[model samples]
Target: MADDLLLGIDVGTTNIKALVFTTGGALAASASVATPTERPHPGWAEHDPHTLWQAVVAVIRRALASIDDLRRVRGLAVASVGEAGVLVGAGGEPLTPIIAWYDQRSAPYAQRWKTHDDPLETFRATGMLAAPIFGIFKLQWLRDYEPEGYAAATTWLHVADYIAFRLCGARTTDYSLASRSMLFDLRARRWSESLIDRAGLRGDLLPELVVSGTRIGAVTPEAAAETGLAPGTVVGAGGHDHVCGALAANVRRAGDCLDSMGTAEAVFLPLDDIPLDERLFIANVSSWTHVTFGAHVARDRYYVMDGLFSSGAAVEWMRRLAAPGASFDEAAAEVETLAASAPPGSMGVLFLPHLAAGERGAFVGLTTSSGRAALARAVYEGLAFEWRHMLDTIEGMLGVRARTIRAIGGGTRLPVWLGIKAHVLGRPIQVLDMDESVALGAALLGGIAAGVYHSEDEAVNALQIRERTVAPDVALHALYERIYREAFLRLAPTLAPVHTALNDLEMI
Candidate 1:
């Protein structure tokens, strides 16, 4: 009985990460490999599926190499960024570059669905509004725009399912990742034939759906050779990155929310019922077996997620403009110090923080009086304000005040930003110590499959713990309330016009 370790792999937006953890949730070793995206045309982002698999294999190999015990690994689990889609031939050879979730090339196809006035019904059925963020839209785009590629495809796979198929020879998707495809029926928990036909998607393209803890298959000998893990290690179907991160943060039930601060920042609230507010829109963040065993979350209990899609992106953009030559850590540190010097409002400079298109949180005002520090502070404030707006809407829907908000991911590295978030949201922020919660959450799925844990709650209780809590300063929170109100007032009316103009400019 070798001391078993669970291995988890994640194929992320800009990096591939592999983590090994004990059943007790202690990280033994980890490795990361940078994976770059290609934009061959405007509004299009892609990565060769082969490139992603190689990256995953490299990171896993590195992680295994770092550890002295090779036979101790019990099982493997995979979690990947959802919505990026890969087309595969009957034999599993790549037929097209993966159209990533961040890719906007599918916007026209998504727009067509809206034009047909068919999105709402689909939303009601699937629990997700059709958008370019979904893999199904990209599949439709391939069918329409790249007829040659579509004709050659036999399977349309989400990034995680594709990787699982390649490594384990199982074309299986977990409940969470499957829910990201708008063609999936949340109530039925399967691909909706009607939705598929309506979207002009081939129903046969989808893989069979499985629950999170189900063992899909064993890693192939070839994958084992490439990754240096034990042959025939069980591969458990994991979940979407955000959902896994939520699990890692211990947000498995109603009233618990998670803030994942990465390239994008989002606040995910798991509800026992679809929140009842007209102002807040419900989209399926990720779906899994309900919090309780043998029980499914009713259509009402689905996850409602709202995001500042450009929040962290805005921060990175400001960092580059403010500290061009500094490392990310150095730049974060500089911004932290400079932001501290500026007042709560950044001296009346309101930044909408919409550096990226197709998302909200646009920065509004800039003047000569606004120094780099002011801009930095405005960037931070804009993100905080964006969160505040979303949280307000969520509370309005939930009709209750949330007590503490759970925060996770790399951005929590900065206390200054966390403090600002606390002040702006007017809630205590509990920061989880694990930065790679997504990978850990995927590993938790492996633990469940390997029979190390009997239930999700038990697994979470044995593993997840809050590391620190940040209480908002009264004065700062008061000042931020005023600033955030004014900032929203100044920016709200401008959103439609600015977005329209941006669309026009992009078209021209």
Candidate 2:
């Protein structure tokens, strides 16, 4: 029983990681490698599928090397960044490079779709905003720019699906990943026929969809040889990396929320049913099927998700700008020390963290006395305020407040940031001790597929989750409450005109 192991491979934008865990939820071994992204042209980002596969293989082999018996590994699954996918040919070869989700090369196609289609109708069907990040737009980009490859492609597989296919020889995808494609019918839980027709894509371009945690197939001999996994090891369906991480954190019930802090941050709040509010669309909040399902969790559950494009990214940017050549930990430590010295409101300085296209980040009310400490503190406060804004918007639309906010990912390593977020939000932030929640969620799914656990509830119950709560500081909370409402909330609207003017200047 102790020998039974589950392997979870997470294909992230930053790194590819393989983690092994026992059925009882204790970590056994792990390995990771940086994910290589190619920027062939400005605004274009892609990953060679072959290179990604090799990285996955290398991590898997390296992780399994610590185990005594390969056959003890019962099941494996993969969780990956959503919306990025590769087109596969009839013979299981990649027809096109995997497009990065954040790439803006498909903007024209997305804009065209927005012009032609009713956005409300699109939102009702897909529960996502019209963005170039969606897989459908990337497919459109391929259809127009690389017609030959698009024509030859038989199936489009999400990053996780592609890796799983390579491992188990299955051409299938899971619902949570499919939801990110912007081609799925959220209510019907299938591909939207009208959207597929509108996009000028073959209806069959997508693969068969399965729920996350469903057993798909077993690792083939070829895959076993490449990854040091036992041949015939059961393979399970996995979902989007964020959803998988949420699952591991046990944010499955209605009213439960997860703040996934990474290169980009997202706030996930699971709901019992879809909210038919147009305001959610306007706010850029997405409602989609969560990785949660079964008799344990609500079967008809969805989640409202939105966040800052630059939560942790803003901090990283500051680190690079102010503490060049310093390691991340070193920079973070300096930031923590400096930020702690600054007062609750960052010494009257305000940071508007809008790092997206057409928007510029700014530090207002800066004086000669303002130093890196106040500037860094302002960045942290700004990130917290932005998340508060997003959460407030979601709460207003949903008519429900999150009862619990669980924090996960790299950003949680920053104690000062966590404390600032807690104080700013006026709520306790539960930081999970699990370092790799996404991979652990994948492992839990693998456990289900391998029959090591009977259900999602049982699999989750097996996890040894330990958490410490960062309670809000009362005095700091009051100070942040006033600052957030007065300064931080107005910062965006105040800078909108300037951002537009700057964009126009760039164009001229």
Say which candidate scores most in lDDT.
2
What TM-scores do the predictions have? Answer: 0.92, 0.95
Each prediction's Cα lDDT score? 0.75, 0.84
Q: lDDT of candidate 2 vs native?
A: 0.84
Query: Per-prediction count of colliding residue pairs?
Result: 13, 0
Alpha-carbon shift of residue 235 in model 1 (angstroms): 0.5
Runs of candidate 1 exceeding 4 Å displacement: 275-301, 357-362, 464-466
Model 2 residue 340 distance off true place after TM-score fit, in angstroms: 1.4
- Tens digits of lDDT, candidate 1, 1-508: 1277888887887678999988767889999988767889876778988878888888888898877867677777888877777878888898888887888877887788768955456666666555677777888878887788789878887888888787789887876777777777776667889988877778888888888878788888988888897777888888888778887787767778778998777777776654222222332222110111011211123576666657677777777787899998887788888888887788778877665536545545677788878878887877788777766666655576666589898889878788888888777988889888889888878777767667777677787455899888898888888877755645756576777777788778
- After the best TM-score superposition of candidate 2, give how far the Cα of residue 182 lies from its true spot, in angstroms: 1.1
Per-residue lDDT for 243 in model 2? Answer: 84
Worst 10 residues of 1 by lDDT: 287-296
